[model samples]
Target: MAADPVVSVDAVSKVFATRAGPVHALRDVSFSVPRGHTLGLVGESGSGKSTIARLVLGLERPTTGAVRFESVDLSAAGRAARKRMRRRMQMVFQDPYSSLLPHLTVLSNVVEPLRLHGIGTVAQRRERATQMLVRVGIGAASAGFYPRQFSGGQQQRIAIARALVLEPEFLVCDEPTSSLDVSVQAQILGLLQGLQRDLGLTCLFVSHNLAVIERMATEVVVMCGGRVVESASTEELFAHPAHPYTRRLLAAVLPLEGDAPPLPADDWDPASLDDDEREVVRISPGHYLRA
Candidate 1:
């Protein structure tokens, strides 16, 4: 039998009231993340991908439906309950520069979560923080330095250490490597993969980079207009993308190499497509198509 999902999102939707009217951010979006697996949520800007992450973290509430963790409804939980649940789930943000506090030492940043959760005594927290830093490839000696003392890659390593210091079961990585150099990105991804293997952690990786998603995700979900347009294993999605929108996205990033030619300007027009062709469609098993 399939293992039970660590997270279950059911018919979730979100709408924001704007001066013009209500903006529907997510519509009947639903998916589940099984224990110890990574799911990549991919989409362009304004595609509601980040919104889903925010909703999962309880930064915003859905207009409809529910979000559950291990069969417990987070959407319906009280503040104290949600706070408690947060210990099991953590987020690693996109920009390492802004994520870490400039004034705080690396050790303090990593131990803050533990302190907030009242995990242990000061000495214990310090020991755990040092160990976590080592796990992320940052030496314990670097723990006394401030965020400004580190390079972009090292700062990100510190951020990862902070996120994992609590030993969370699930991690929401919101474009964590997007702001780094190509080499640093690869290093960070490798570090994350190693940590996941060592800890058996589940991950919700959100990114616009198809190549990055392909490398990190066991399964992938493509989002558009705040809803899932396609969902499939990384291999299957790349081998045979069924959604027209998904195809267009792939085409935009096509050639996938330095030597490939760009698409013709005329072929980029969106107004020329039919409504169904523009919409996302559910296709083969474990795969959905948009148009």
Candidate 2:
């Protein structure tokens, strides 16, 4: 039998009430994250990638449709139920500096989640936190150190440790490596990939960096104007992008030689194409495109 999806988003829509009118943030957004797989959500700023993460986390409710986890609709779940669901899902934010508390020691930071969930005794929590820190490549000797004492990459690893302390099955990584140097970014991505494999975690990776997405995602979803313009497996998406937006994003990624000119902004415009050209084309099984 096929493994059940860990998370499901069904025709969900999000709208903000503005002075001018209702501003639609997400429109008919739909997808499923299969068990132990990674799904990458890619788009420029204001494309609603973060919004989807928030919606899934119960930080915001959808204006229409539902978000379900294993057939339980998150939008309709009670507070206690939602709280319980959170133990299965956790988040790693974009900025490591902001995510970690200045006054808290690394041990405290990692144990905070356990404390909040009322899991284990104090001694057990500390031991588990220490083990987690080591698992994420931070030494146990550094547990007494503050967030400021570590480099950007180490801080991010601490953040990852904190998120993983609960042994969550699904993780929402919102630009987790966007702020790091190229080398550090690679390290963090590799660490994440390793952890996911070891723990059988499902990830929804949200980023605007197509190259990074190429490295991390098993499947890719291209978003624009709060809608999914294209979806495909990573290899198929890169090899045969069907949507004009996807093509534009792929083109924007700097070549390995680092000498290619930056892609022009006009390349992202869907309006430039006629209706016939605007439709997403299917280049292969599980690959799609939008003009």
Candidate 3:
């Protein structure tokens, strides 16, 4: 997560009513996913990353602000209108095992959205689903098998296939690789990046993992306690994290085996930098360490 680069401001908030009372969810969160760009929303559990996913998908409306898709105000749209808009956007949830229908066959699961949307004739829908499955590396022979038959990675591939079966303009991936083995994680990510490139997908990729976000997102919006703590292009955010929380996140990153953070050259002095930025010691021109 990157810091708010422009100006400082006081925070507003969002709450939900329940029998227990109002529970705070989000605070003055704002950012946009440009056409064909991936907006990474990274935060710890209960930080409202998934809440933003639901809001953007029109499954939940923001209490104070609006969630727009292709200039359509989803928060204000009618049910019928939202249904129509849903065809152009799709979501892949964290758990591939649960996100997909266990009872349905892989082919049927992918075809469900097309059937619901009345997308095409039965034959055409089956063809589309098959094509998607093939693209995601699931063969036509495995299409008749139920979800329980596939490995977690395979199940996720099927889930991604289902999400893309509609040829969606926007893709919302909510921790799509968190539950897999390390090797499988890379495979899934590579698959997603390849798909995103080929499809020109505008994506909202949510994850608590900064490494994954760095690999996937074009721009990033860092959320904490339901508030957007920082927003910036991926390079800018990782190279120059401005907020204290953002810096903490960077520090928390575990370096890969045989890799370590590079030390500063020691030629530069703290007196050379701006007063506001002096709190963090410069590790390099674009890197910092909280003093």
- Per-prediction TM-score: 0.91, 0.92, 0.85
Per-residue accuracy of model 1 over 253-285 as CA lDDT, tens digit each: 645567445333334433233122344456776
Question: What are the per-model C-alpha RMSD values against the true structure?
Answer: 3.0, 3.0, 7.2
> Residue by residue across 12-66, what tens digits does model 3's lDDT show?
2457899999877866666667776788888778878988888878777677866
CA-lDDT, candidates in order = 0.85, 0.88, 0.79
What's the lDDT for candidate 2? 0.88
Please name the candidate that would achieve the greatest lDDT relative to the true structure.
2
Q: What's the TM for model 3?
A: 0.85
Candidate 1 is scored at a TM of: 0.91
Whichever of 1 and 3 has more lDDT, that candidate is 1
Query: Can you give the lDDT of residue 249 in candidate 3?
Result: 67
For candidate 1, the C-alpha RMSD (Å) to the true structure equals: 3.0
Q: Provide backbone clash counts, one per model.
A: 5, 4, 0
lDDT of 2 by residue, 152-252 (tens): 99999999999999999899999999999999999999999999999999999999999989899999999988888899989888776767787788778
Span of ten consecutive residues with least summed lDDT in model 2: 270-279
**Candidate 3: lDDT over CA atoms?**
0.79
